[model samples]
Target: MKAVVVNEGGALSIQNIEMPKITSPDQILVKVAYCGLCGSDIPRIFHHGAHFYPITLGHEFSGTVVDTGHGVTEFDNGDLICCVPLLPCFKCDECQKHYYSLCKNYTFVGSRIAGGFAEYIVLDKKNAFKLPKGISPLEGAFFEPMTVGMHALLLADGCEGKNVVIVGGGTIGLLAMQCAKAMGAKSVAVIDINQQRLDLAKKLGADAVYHSQKLSSEAIHQALSSSRFDQVVLETAGSPVTVNLSIEIAGPRAKIALVGTLHHDITLPEKTFGLILRKELQILGSWMNYSAPWPGKEWQLVSQYFIDGKIKLDELIAGMGDFDSFIKQVTALNGRPMNGKILLNCM
Candidate 1:
């Protein structure tokens, strides 16, 4: 098997490696099919290092089951599946409360262990799910990110029957928009620094789009036909600018979910901080999902939506290539602007 290995110095090299085998009775071995490149992968590959040197990093992926342990009854050979990356110790306090993401003893695929960038990866049967009928392997790869969006929307208090604003048009941001609409948002406006992404956002059900460079309260009001987004605002850009702007774009008493991650210290702007007080907004910081309502509802909901034809992710796919192309594309992702998700055909 071959995988793009991130060496200790953050250099990416495609190298032949031993294939992972089922190490536990509850585990399943899968043949990697399509893996999507995440924005976080950019820094993890070029700047921040992985959990260990020579690790393969790809969490948003889907594949066919090559073999399943005898204990696995739900899935069998050749069934398409995607998995929630978090592997929680069910005995922890957080896990007892079904908040797996907050579990103290959680491990992650593609981060803490070997992942989908390779020709084969192993997943605990509990973490793997068979893709619903009518969903292709590529669309199956969307399950993870859609779950993130679903979790963020839940943090924003459901998005039902109210206008919303999403402050980023990247993959996560766009998925958040779809989740909002699916949850019955009255309308949505997506703001981004990249016009190309904003255009893509509009094509994928964003009612309106704005470039952050020229955004203003009045401009956003005009776009959504309201003084502010009274329902919810999800900040997926994770910069000081977008997070603050989510505050500015929110209406009085609105709930704001900060979903993006900022890697460094941020000096909070005075005016934005004051707005929180004046508006009496409920500002919440959302992290990885609790996987609640039902175990893995995030994955189930996204899967059913795709199965029912309520959602289609064709527009989010920008390109497809082999392992080498994935490396080149991801290397340039952070510093450049691209509008869609790039998938690597791992065969």
Candidate 2:
């Protein structure tokens, strides 16, 4: 098996490694075909180490089952599948209450353990979800990201006929923009510092797009004819600027969902901090997708949206490359932002 491993000092290498195998009767071995480069993978590779060094790093993926353990009845040797990356201890308090994302005892694929960066990875049947008929390996690989966008919307609650603003045009941001529209937002706007990404957001269904370099938060009011969102989604959490910006743009009593990962502390300026109290805003923090309903019900809805042509990724797939080339793509992309998804052709 070949995998891209993170060794000491966060260095990455595409090396041939031992093949992962099923240790329990409920496990299944998937021959990874395609794996998408998630935003989270960049930091783990180049900065803070998640688990021990020498671990694989990829979670957004889909593959075919090459082998199944004796107890795996729902999946066969040839089944195409996507998986939930979180490996939760089912006996934990959170897991028992159907809150797997909040489970205190958990190991995440691509972080705490070997992930889809390898040729083959083993998973329990509990984490695997069969892809729908005709779902391509590339599309199946994106199921995780789609679920992420869905969960963010779920956290924000209603979107029907209300103005919404997404404060980042990355994968999660773009997906949230489309999901907001699909769920019936009267109009949606996407804000990002990158012009190319904001342009892609417009193409994807955002009614308005703002490049932070060209448009100030107040400038958005003019773009949308003095409109303010009933809800605001802050998806660019890594930046303190965007976190404060989310607070600046939210409407009175509007809810804000913090879906982005904020690696650093966010210190709100006096006026910005005052917005929450002045507007009576509701700030909701959301984490990973769930599996209480069995590998997550949001996965099912996202798959169906793809099937019905309401959602598509043809424009978002920037390129696909082999293992070594895949490493370069992600390495370069971390510094230079692009409009859509990039994948490693693990096969």
Candidate 3:
């Protein structure tokens, strides 16, 4: 089998590696179909952020089951599935409490072990989720990011009948906007530095879009006809600026979910810090997408929404190609402004 391997010092190559086989009774061997490139992949591939060298980095992927071990009863050959990349130790205290995402000992697929950037891979039965009939392999590949947005919403206690503000227009941010609308938010507003993403947000049903570069925080409030968002504010940009903006624009007692991965230190201004006390805000720190019963409701809901046509993914795909094209795309990541998801067809 051929797999894309990231060697030490950030060099990538497509090499022939031995095919992974099912070694556990609760495992399944899958033929890779599609894999979505995540924003985090950029750092791991180019910035030496990987846990180890010679890694195959891809977590958001979908595939077809070719064989299942005897212990796997829920899935069989020919099943279309999307993977839950977290491999949690079921014996840990966090795992005992059904907090799989917070498990003290956890290994991720793309980061800690072999991932789905190849022709085939093996997955534990617990990590493989079957896709519904209407969802395509490309759409199935989106399940991971879609679940991420849904996980943030769940942490904020959902968005129904509330004014929601998402402070990013990347794939996760845009998906959160659509999920908010699908869950019956009164209004959904998206803020971003990128005009292309803002436009894409509007096309996907955002009630309003704001270019962060052009609008002052005051102006954004005025445009929305509100002093601040009263219900929910999701900070998904993972930047210091957007983090503070989420604090600035949140109304009293608003449930604010921090969904993005922060790479820099953030020191809140005195006024910003004071708002938390004065407004009695609910600050929720969202982690990876997982809950009780293994992969949890986030995955189930995302799969159902995709089947029901409540979410749109085609517009979020900025590029798609095979392995050679994937190599070129990876090379182009430096100094490039990526506004959408890039996909690789592994088979």
Clashes of each: 0, 0, 0
Give the better candidate number (1 or 3) by TM-score: 3
- Candidate number with greatest lDDT: 3
lDDT tens digits, residue span 1-347, model 3: 98999876667899998999999999999999999888888888877888989899898999999999989999979999998999899898889998898998988888888899999999988778898898899888988988888998988888888899999999999988988888889999999988988888889999889998999876775676662555799999999999888877777788889999998999999998898888789999999899877789898888778777899888888888999898888778763436688888976
What tens digits encode model 1's per-residue C-alpha lDDT throughout 1-347?
A: 88978876557789988888887888999998888877777666766657677778888889999898888998989899986677888988888888787888878888898778878888998777788778988888888888887887876668788888888888899888988888788998889988888888888888888887976865664565573545788888888878777777778888888899997777768887899999899988887755764346777778777877767587788887898887777665643535688888975
For model 1, the run of ten residues with the poorest summed lDDT: 221-230
Regions more than 4 Å wrong, model 1: 218-230, 293-295, 332-339
Model 1, 260: alpha-carbon shift in Å? 0.4
Cα distance off (Å), candidate 3, residue 313: 1.3
**Highest TM-score against the true fold, candidate:** 3
* Residues 1-347 of candidate 2: C-alpha lDDT, one tens digit per residue: 88888776656788877788789999999999899878787767767645677678889999999998998899998889987898888898889887888989988878777789888999888768898897888888988988887776776765777788888888878776777777788888888888888778888888788887777877764565556646555565457888888877677777788888877888988988898999899988878887557666678778887777677687788878998888777777544444578888976
Clashing pairs in 2: none
Candidate 2 Cα errors over 4 Å, as ranges: 222-229, 333-339
CA error at residue 204 for candidate 1, angstroms: 1.4
